[model samples]
Target: MTEVRGVVATGKGKPVEVTTIHVPDPGPGEAVVRVQACGVCHTDLHYREGGISDEYPFLLGHEVAGVVDAVGEGVQDVAAGDFVVLNWRAVCGSCRACRRGRPQYCFDTRNATQPMTLPDGTPLSPALGIGGFAEKTLVHAGQCTKVDPAARPAVVGLLGCGVMAGIGAAVNTGGAGPGDSVAVIGCGGVGNGSIAGAHLAGVRKIIAVDTDPAKLDWARRFGATHTVNATDHDTVQAVRELTDGNGADLVIDAVGVPQTYTQAFYARDLAGTVVLVGVPSPDMRLELPLLDVFARGGALKSSWYGDCLPERDFPMLTELHHQGRLPLEEFVTEEIPLDDVEGAFEKMQAGAVLRSVVAF
Candidate 1:
């Protein structure tokens, strides 16, 4: 067993603890990663607040950039010293989705067979099956996707979740393309990422809607051609006005609330798509007119991890960042140590920063 320090959520609605844990040696089909940096995602905060489930002590943190330290007997795709980005999706090829040639909608994903534990041998539930907020983590070999070694760990790691999910909501799920007019509601990390993705795809007009003026200004920095302060304007009306009195070709509800979802639904042109990428609480419900749902004449979809295939996206997006096409650096607001995760979560709640990455 290899000893490492990691963050843990000991109970529901409790503060996270940074404690020592034992990570077992890589078993068959597993790899040990020396975590370089992990992003302080809202999901980690959710796990701490008991929003995810009752699994405790839950090992928190998931968005990770690391280097391979060891690999098990069956691992060949990645090896020691290889820099990689950790992902939760380790597609099982035999799943029905894979057999149908749509591995992106993979039904069966992988995790380590052996468990990392507390010093006394109590098993711990690694957050999102990754538990990247540590010096080292054990994962299935397929979870590691080798990306360009030149990319900065702090910035690139965000792509492992929020950023990729936003981009995928636009490009993949929404089918946003050149000549498309796109409107994104909620200009947070994910929403800004959608704006950037729309710009990268050559969308002619990109409209950003948010209640906070600061977030709207930040959205403009990424690629929003038009900004609508939702506090002072009707979101749907603003979006339609920005799209020349009709509506956008693609509307993304990155906020995931009922009001924002309704705005996204009505803010689209005829046959335009609406992509819901924001996470909603289990109790949340959407009450829409059944006739409107049928008359909308377009797709209403949800993007999971932005429908991303890490093996294909990480390397390509890294290259885009290197070429100065994608403004990835804009996402890193600060870099904090592992212990500052609690403080980071506070800031995340306040919307004071886009991301506060933990650098190991």
Candidate 2:
């Protein structure tokens, strides 16, 4: 086993701490990653708040870019020295989803069999199956999605989660295309990512909605053609006016609240697609008019991880970033040390940053 320092959350609704943890050597089909950069996502905060589960001493941080340090028996796809972006879902090929050629919805995903624990041997539940807030972490070999080494670690690593989900929501789920008008209800990393995706897909109009003016400003950098201040105006009405009173062709709810979801539902054109990429709270309930649901003549889908295949999408998007097609680096509002995670979370709550990446 290898001893490393990791950011761990010890209790529900408690602050996280950087403490010494023991990461075991790779077992069969597993690999050890020497983390270079990891993004502080909302999901990490969710885990700390016990929104994901009651699992304590949770190892937070998952959107990571790292170098493979070791591999165990039967690992062949990646080896030592490979720079990779970690993904939560590493499909088991024999699973029902994979057998049907839809590995994005894999019923069985894999992680390391060995546990990463505290120095006292207390087990730590790694967030999203990736304890990447540490100097080094063990994960399933397939979780390592290789990207171009030339790309910035913090930049591409954001694609490990939120950014990927947003982009995939627009490009993969919504299938936004040329001349299409798209409305993204949120201006966070995921919302801005959807704007970028729509732009890359040749979308002519991208409407960005948010209560924060700073986020609205940031949305423009990602190619949002219009901005909607939700606090000042009716989001649905503004979207309709911007799209010739017909509403947007595609509407993505990146903020998973009932209010925003309702806005997205009504802000789309007839036969338009509505993609929900945000993670909603368990207690939150939806009470849309069943008649409206039946009257909306389009598909309404929830995007799980943007329906993205890491192997296929990661490299392609990173390449686009390299070619100056995707402005992914803009997502990194600040680069911080692992110790500043709590501060980063504060910044996240205040809507002061798009993403605060921990650079080891």
Candidate 3:
């Protein structure tokens, strides 16, 4: 076992603390990662606030990149010293989705069988099966996707989650192509990533909608051709106006709220796709007119992890970043030590950053 200092959320609505945790040696099909960087994501905050489950003493922070430090017996795909990005979906090849050749929707993903625990032997629940807030973390070998070693850890690590979600939402789930018109609601990191992905896919018109002016400005930097402040105007109307009095070919709701989703539903052209990438609370409900659903004549899809296959997508995205085509560096708003996680969460809650990465 390895003794590592990690941030732990002891209970709901309480601040996390730096404590010593024991990361056991990798078991069969598992590997140990010496984390180089991990991004502060909203999911971590959700876990800390008990939005995920009742599991306490949660080890949070999932978006990560690192070097493989060790591998257990039967692990052949990756070895020690290999640079990798951690992924939550460690697909089980025999699952129904995998059998159908859609491993991205693998119903039975792999995770570490051995638990990382506190010094007192209390078991720690890893966030998204990857608690990377520590110096090191243990995960299934399948969860480690090899990437270009030259890429900056802080920037590339963002691909492990939100950034990937946004990009894949456009290119993978939405099937955006050349000359398509796209509109993204919620101009946060994920939304801007969708805009960037659309641009890369050769979309002709990209409209960004958000209540925050700062985020809208950031969206423009990410490839938004037009910006609409949702707080100042009707989002659906604005999107329609930007697309020549017709709605966009694709409308993405990155905010996940009922209102934003409704806006996205109404902001798409006939037969256009509506992709919901934002996560919603359990209490939130949607009540659209039943007749309208049939009348829309389009797909209403929900993107999980942007429908990405990490093994296929991660390397390509890293190459794009390296080629200066993806602008992955722009998503990183700040970098801080692991100790600053609490403060980073504060900034995230206040909408002050796109991403605050933790550098080890």
Candidate 4:
């Protein structure tokens, strides 16, 4: 075991604190990672607020990039020196989803068999099974996906979560490609990722929708051909006008609220795809007309982690960023120390930055 300083949320709505914790040496099928950088994702805040579970003293932070520090028995794919991105969905190859050859939807995922704990021996529940806001963390060996060592840890670490989700929502789930007209509702990290993905796929018309002009500008940097200020105009109408009155071929709702989702539903062309990459609150409900669901003549799909296979996607994305084809580095609005996570959360809530990454 080793001692490390990490951000921990001890109770619901409590501010996270940088405190001492114990990271066990990798057990069988596990690996210990020396974290280089980790992004401040909204999901981490959700965990801190007890929105995810009642697991208090939660080890917060998930989106991570690191180097393998140690590997346990029988691990061969990664070694002590490999640069990697830690992913939550460590697929179990024998699960039902994997048996059917769709490991992205693997029915069973794995985490380190042993626990990370506090000084008093209380176990910490890792946010999404990757407690990365620390100097080092232990995870399932499969969680470590080797990527280009040349890539910046602060930039590529985001692919561990939101960025990947946004990109996958468009490319993998939405099947965006050349000649497609895509509209993304929301201009945050995930939304900009969708815009970037659509750009990568060579979509002809990319429309960005948001209330914040600054975020819309960020969307343009990612790759939006047009912008719609939703606060001033109706979202569906603006998207339709931009797409030649036919609506976008693919509409992504990156904001998980009912209003944005409804806008996405009505803003797609006939037979167009609508992908929901945003996570909605558990208590929130949608009340769309049942007839509309049947008559839309398209698919309404919810994306979990952008339906990504981390092992396959992470390396590919890192290489793309390294090639300068994808401006992944632009996503990092600021770099912060691990101790400023509370301030980072405040900045996130105030819409002050796209991402505040913790660089170890």
Error of 4 at 288 (Å): 1.2
* Candidate with best lDDT: 3
Mark the 10 consecutive residues where model 1 has the least summed lDDT: 235-244
Model 1, 284-350: lDDT tens per residue? 9999999999988988898988898899998999999999999999989999999999899999999
Clashing pairs in 2: none
RMSD of each: 0.8, 0.7, 0.7, 0.8
Whole-model lDDT values for every prediction: 0.91, 0.94, 0.95, 0.94
Q: Which lDDT tens digits does candidate 2 get at residues 1-360?
A: 999899999988778899999999999999999999999999999999999999798999999999999999999999999999999999899988899998989999988889999998899999999988999999999999999988889899999999999999999999999989999999899999999999999999999999999999999999999999999999999999999899999999999999999999999998899999999999998889998989988989899898999999999999999999999989999999999999999999999899999999
| C-alpha TM-scores of all predictions | 0.99, 0.99, 0.99, 0.99
The deviation in Å at residue 279 for candidate 3 is 0.3
lDDT score at residue 227, model 2, on the 0-100 scale: 97
Judge candidate 2 at residue 62 and give its lDDT.
97
Per-residue CA lDDT of model 3 for 212-285, tens digit only, reads 99999999999999999988999899999888878999999999999999999999998899999999988999
Writing each residue's lDDT as its tens digit, candidate 4 over 1-360 gives: 999999999999989999999999999989999999999999999998888989788999999999999999989999999999999999999988999998888888999999999999999999999999999999999999999898889999999999999999999999999999999999899999999999999999999999999999999999999999999999999998888899999999999999999999999998889999988888888999998888889888888888899988999988888888999988999999999999999999988999999999
